[model samples]
Structures are given as structure tokens and as C-alpha cells.
Target: MAATEITLEVARYRPGVDSEPVLQSYQVPLREHWAILDGLTYVKDHLDGTLSFRWSCRMGICGSCGMTVNGEPQLSCATFLTDYAPGPIRVEPLHNFPVVRDLVVDIDDFMTKLPKVKPWVIREVQSPIEEGEYLQTPEEMDECQQFSMCINCMLCYSACPVYSLEPDFLGPAAIALAQRYNLDSRDEGADERRDVLSSPEGIWACTFVGECSAVCPKGVDPAGAIQRYKLTAATQSIKELLMPRSLIPRSKG
Candidate 1:
């Protein structure tokens, strides 16, 4: 039998009021088209205005509404309640990060780490203003197109056991974003990003658990990116070691 209404077991927490997060249930009308985010909106609008969560662009582009649904990380705006059917649904803040309140996890950690990987194009020299834009071949665009889809949803981080265990880990999304720029023919920043990404807590920290790729709604395979970085870093190290001592560049004191 199809359920007319579904119960949402939403996690609730307030800094001074609650010592720990608690699940609060609310029966919401089960519309086939309604997503879990809609149910949360209904709760905020009618049942409890105090209920807190994060959401934007209800279309899943913003990636702000990421949360643990039935123990799996997902964007609430894109997850249909009808899929679960006939009963209650569990919703909690994303794992592997500190919760800000209720469904909002503190993303400051990721924000801080993102810049360290330098997820942007770099050029050794500045082009003149009249020179127009840097061009890339079709193949070049294709090289980074898949990785460019990441929305910073952090679902990958939540699903990553390595990141959960080691907070310093550069993590899947950051490394993949770095690769996104690194693969760009217009970007000459691979060497700049390599130092941070090749460090102990970067790509090497990933054990290729692949859960990061599995949980990504955008289809960005962060695991593959990490593996690629490992190979590239290893090959560069070998070349440097093999090069004659006289040919190696040295910095002046």
C-alpha cells in the first residue's frame, strides 16, 4: 500500500539548549514529487519554525543541503521521499565534520583546505589584455570536464573513511578539484598544486576506498583523480631522481 504520509526522523540540535543532537519526527504529506528537502521546508513552515537546516537552489546545484539520509550522504533537495516509502526516513548532518546546529555541518574545514590545493588556473606569465583568452583543444576540455562537475557537496567527504579518521586529509573533492585545474591546458598550476597534494595528508591519504565516488551525486570520480595524482607524482619523482646532478636546477642562497 502506498503511504499517504511519511514520518521524517530529523535530527535537531541547539548549542545551549541541547547537549547532543536528537531526532524529532514529523508526519509530512507524501507527494510523489516531493523531495526530502520539501518535507523539511514543510516542517519549518508549519510544524516548527525553529527547525534548522541548510538548502539553496532546490535543484541540487548549490550542494548546501547535503545530509545523511538513512546513513548515506545525499543532497536532500535531490532525494525523493517516495523512494523510501511506507514509513519513517532518517536525516542527520553529514558525518566526518562537526555539526553547526541541526542539519548544517561546519564547512569551514573544507573551505580552509580548498585554497591550500590551489583549485584555480595558474600561468607562469601574464598575457597582455589585448591577447584575448587562453585557448584549449577539444581533448583538453574533455580531460577536465568530468572533474569540473563537483559542486562541493561534501558527500564524498562524508563517505570517505580516510577523511573521517584523519581530518587533515586533503580529501577527495579538494584533490579532484586540483586535478580539474591541473588537467586544464590553460592552467600551468600543476607544479604549484603538487606540493600540497603530494604531501602525506593529500592524495596518499586516500586508500582508494571508492566510497567517495559512489556517494557523489555529480558523478565526479574523486578516487580516480587521487589515483591519477599518485601516478603523476610518482613518475615525476622518478624523473627527478634519474636526472643527472648537473642538469637539476638549484635555488641560489
Candidate 2:
């Protein structure tokens, strides 16, 4: 027999009132189709209207509903409540970030670090509007396609042990997004992004624990992206040492 009700132990925090977060339990209907987000919604609507969390789209595309579900970083909308079965389901804010209220975390650090990598195409001179859009072949698009799937959900950051230990680490999503723009044939920003990506806080900070890729709901292999960039950075360093600056071809952006 399947249990109809399940206890959701959701973390609760209210600034200026609560010094720290506390787990508040709520009994919710455990339908087969009920996701963790659905249970949370039910709790908010019926049990406690003061319970706070961030969720949008509710379909996993918005990446706004990311939270720690049973010790794993996951999108609440995609994590079914029935999977946990007959008991309490632990739900909390993503790790390595300051909890704003309950499930909502402060993403100010990620937002600040993202722009440092210049995750955009760089062109020394803009082409005239009449020149039309920059074209890319299938092969060219494939180079950066895998890395471009990141939606900035910050799940990778939550799963990364390095980010937890070192708050200044550039983090998995930001590094992978940098690789996305770097590998894009239409983008010439690789040279511009190299300084940040090769810095102490960037790819070097990642110890290849690979939890970032494991927690990613978008199937983006951020660990692999970091490895790829490390190789590229290393190769560039070798060339710079062996070849004269004038002799080495400059990257045309």
C-alpha cells in the first residue's frame, strides 16, 4: 500500500527574527504526480502562507526552483515527492550561499563573478548592419553547444566542494559559460576571457571532484568544460614560452 501523506521538513528562516534557519515540518498529500514543488505550494496555500521560497515556470526550464532535496541539489519542480515515499522529505536552500529567507539563496556572488569572464562574443570592430548575422557551420556550433546549456541555476556551485571551502572560487557554471563563449567560432572573446579563466580562483580552484556535473539538471558537464579550458590555457602557455611574441599569430577577435 502507498502512503497518501508525506512529511516535508522544509528549512525556514526569517531575517531579523530568526538567527538561523530551522526545519519546519508539514504534512502534504503524496500523490504520484506531486513533485516537491507541488508539496511546497500546497503547504504555502493551505498550511502556512508565510513560508518563503523562490519558484518560477515550475517546469524546470526557468531554473528558479533549485534547492537541496534530501542532501542533493535538484530542481524542486522535477523532483517528485513520491520518490521519497512514506516519510519526511528534507528540503533546504542550495548550499554554499547565504539563505535569504528559506529556499531562496543570495546569488550576488555568482552574478558578480559571471561578468568577469565576459561570457559574450567579442569583436574588435562591429560589422555594419547590412553585413548580416555572423554565420557558423554545424561543426562550429557543435563545439560550444554542450557547454551552452547552462541556465545559471547555480546547482553546480552548490554541489562543488571547492566553492564551499573557498568562497572566491570562480565556480562551475561561470567557468563553463566562459568555455561556451570561448568555443563559439563566431565569438572572439577567448583571449579576453583567458586572464580570468586561468587565474588562481578560476579553473585552478576546481579540484575535479565532478559533483558539479552530477547535480546539474541541464546535463551540462561543467567538470569537462573546466578540464577542456585547463588544457587550452596550458597549450597557450607553452606556445608563449617557446615562440616569440611577434612570431606567434595573434587571436583575431
Candidate 3:
């Protein structure tokens, strides 16, 4: 017969109470359809009322249920408890981030760095309202569509070794989102983003570990985006060396 229950070793941290995070174990029914998030919910409702975590849409689209499950970054809402059957499963806040309460982590660093990349369509001059929206061909859309799939889930950042060591790094999600806009045919802010993208703490800091891509639940390859941006930055540097800035054509808006 299959196991009837599973033990979850969840990390708990409460400010002014616990000196450090402690693992608290709880047993919940093992159902085939139940996910790790469901197990956590069970603990909160039935086992421990003070258990805390962040989750919105149970669907993977929200990307808010990201956490470390058994030493790997995963979306607790999508990772079923049945996968790790017959034993204890560990759940903790995402790596490389400060734990807020229990499974909740402080993402203020990422929030501040995201805007620095200016991940939005920018135009020096905007057309009047009567002009309608800017249009793009399917081919043009394909250039940045992969990067646009990122839901700002910091899983990539948590899996990235570089971000763990260097907190100043702009991080995979921010860089990938930056490429989403930089590659957009209607965007003209490539030059404006050049300073941040090419800085020492930006793409240069990424060692291309590829963990950022491996752990991306959305199938987005942040490692590839960073590499592509590096090439673009290098080409721009060569052009500047060969010709004057005034002669170099500005990126199309």
C-alpha cells in the first residue's frame, strides 16, 4: 500500500522570538493531487496557525509561490508532494535572500534593481493619441518573446551562484527583462540602458553558470539573454572604437 501521510520539515523564523530559523515538522495527508503549497496550507490551517508564506494564484502563472523545496528552487504550488513520497520533504525560503518571517523573503533588492534596467518600451518622442499603438510583425515579436515570459519569479536569482556571492549583481530576472525591452522593435532606449547593462555589476558579473536557466519554471533562459546582451555590448564597443558616436546610427525606436 502507498504511504498515507508525509512529513514536511518547514523552516520557521519569527523576529524577536527565534534567534535563527528552525525547522518545524508537521505531518499531512499524502494525496496524489496535493502540491507542496497545499501541504503548507494544511499546516497553517490545521496544524500550526502561525505558519506564514506567500502565495497568490495557485496556478503557476502568478510566480508568487516560489520557494526552496528539498534544496532546489521550485514553485510550491506546482511541485506535488507525491513526487517526494514515503519520507520527509523540506521547504524553506528562497536562497540568497533575507527571510522575512517564515517562508517569506525580502525582495526589496530585486525590486530596486528591476527599475534600473528600465524594462519598458521607451521612445524619445511619443506620437499623439490619434496615431494609435505601435505595431510589430510576428518576426519582430519573436526576438524578445522568450525573455518576456519571465514573471519576475526570483527563482532564477535564488539558483544563481553569482547573485549569492555578489549581492550588487543586477540578477538574472532583471537582466532578462531588460533584454525583453532592448530587443523590442518599438523600443529606442537601448542606448539609455547601455550604462547599466554593461556595468561591472551587471552582465559582466554573471559567470554563465546556467543555473538561472535550469531553474526557470517559465522556460525562460536568462543565461542566454545575458550572453546575447554581452555580444551586443561588445559590438557597440567595437563600433565606438572604429567610428565617432555621432556617425553611429541610433537604435531604431
Candidate 4:
């Protein structure tokens, strides 16, 4: 196999000028170890300076380089160029989001939806100034630690058919974050959180497409968190109907 010379068929769009996106090709030199991000960088530096994409930390940790490589959600940094190279490789911004420019999509919609989920540990009460930290056993942290790896890349949203079909769906990352708080022993917002989870745009929109889990670079199984949230939500609903007292979260007092 040749080490260099691979064609990248990149999607191009200038928002106000173009009706829709179009493909433009660029020839980039590839090494077996070179990531797709490097290929895009080469194309941008040499050929098309207008091509846009997001990348940070060149390591896979940032998740900013997420995009669709040949119709599949992937981290450009993690995806090797030679893996798909005999010739042209199709690259585009993540699907199910509005394109801001060529291959750059606007993630403001996701950022807007995230805060509504209350993705934080709500302490029952503020600790004293002398208090140092909230300690957790290994088991306690392990219960929900895996969900915290999300880098907010929106690849899961891109892979999610539900988010694409229903624009209002709360989506994988937010749901995963919601689960993150729900599982934390320090959080006390479980009952208050139901309004977001039970609404039309919430968990019901998901059809278990599981593409979010499959495409996750950090192995954060959003599908599993969503399922657990559904289960917890159902149990809460049942308890509220029967016991009534359980509908309200226990107060720290």
C-alpha cells in the first residue's frame, strides 16, 4: 500500500451562499500512523483554508474532532487515515446538527439543552469552611464514574436517530449527564429532576437505537444510562402513586 497520497472528499458549505452542502476533494499525504485530523489539517493548511472543523488535544481526550467519517460517527484524531485509504474518504461534520460552515456544526443547541438537565451534584447542605472534600468509596464512584467521561463532542447526538427525527429529544450526552447526577450520592434533586426526564422531549423519544453507545470514543454507554434512568423514573412513578410520601425527595435536614 502506498504511504502517501489519499483523496479526502470533504463536504463544503458556505451558509448564506449555498443552498446545501457539496463535496470538494483534496489530496493529502497520509502515513499509516497519521490520524484523519492530520489529513484535514494538511488540506486546510495547503489547499482549502476555508474548510472548517474542530480539534483540540490531538489526543482522543478532547472529543472536539468528532465527525462522520464515511457516514459513521468517529473522532478524527482516533481514526487513522490509512485505515480507509485506497483512495477517497468521505468526511463531514456530525449529522443531526446545523452546519455553521463547511464541516463545522453549531453545538449551541446541545449547550442550551445541557443546563436544563441540571448536570451537577446538588449537595443536601453546604459544608463548613473547615470541611475539605466529599469522599466516596470506590464502589460509590464506580457506580456512575464511567458516565463522566463524555467530552460533550455531540457524536452521540449525531449518531442518534431519535435526536435527528425529533429535534427536541434530550439526547445521549445530556441524558448521560443527568444519570451522572442521579447516581451521585451527594445529589438530592431526584424528584425535581423528573420534570425534564418525563417530558415529551425527554426519555420517551429514544427508541434504543444504541448508535450513541457504539460511536462513543470514551466507551460511555449513554444507552445504558438512559435505560437505567427510565427504570429509576418508572420506579419513582410507581412509588409516588402508591406511597405518596416517596414522591418528594428526602430532605437533608
Q: Mind sharing the TM-score for model 1?
A: 0.95
Question: Which residue pairs collide in model 3, if any?
Answer: none
lDDT of 4 at 96: 97
> Whose lDDT is greatest here?
3
Model 2 lDDT tens row, 1-253: 7778999999999999999999999999989899999999999999999999899998888888899999999999999987898779999999999999988899999999999999888876889989999899999899889888888899999999999999999999999999888888888778888899999999998899999999999988999999988888887789999987577665422
Candidate 3's residue-wise lDDT over 24-133, tens digit each? Answer: 99999999999999999999999999999999999898888899999999999999999999869999999999999999999999999999999999988998879999
How many backbone clashes can be found in candidate 3? 0
Q: Ten residues in a row with the worst lDDT in model 1? A: 244-253
Q: What's every prediction's RMSD, in angstroms?
A: 3.3, 1.6, 1.3, 2.3
At residue 60, candidate 4 shows an lDDT of 89
Task: Sort all candidates by TM-score, best to worst.
Answer: 3, 2, 1, 4
In model 1, how large is the Cα lDDT of residue 86?
Answer: 75
- Against the reference, the lDDT scores of all candidates come to 0.91, 0.91, 0.93, 0.86
Task: Score residue 4 of candidate 1 by CA lDDT.
Answer: 92
User: What's the alpha carbon RMSD for model 4?
Assistant: 2.3
In model 1, residue pairs whose N, Cα or C atoms come closer than 3 Å (at least 3 residues apart or on different chains), thus clashing, are none
Clashes of each: 0, 0, 0, 0
List TM-scores for all candidates, in order.
Answer: 0.95, 0.96, 0.97, 0.94
92-131, model 4: which lDDT tens digit per residue? Answer: 9899999999888989899999999899877668798699
The residue ranges of model 3 lying beyond 4 angstroms of the native Cα positions read 251-253
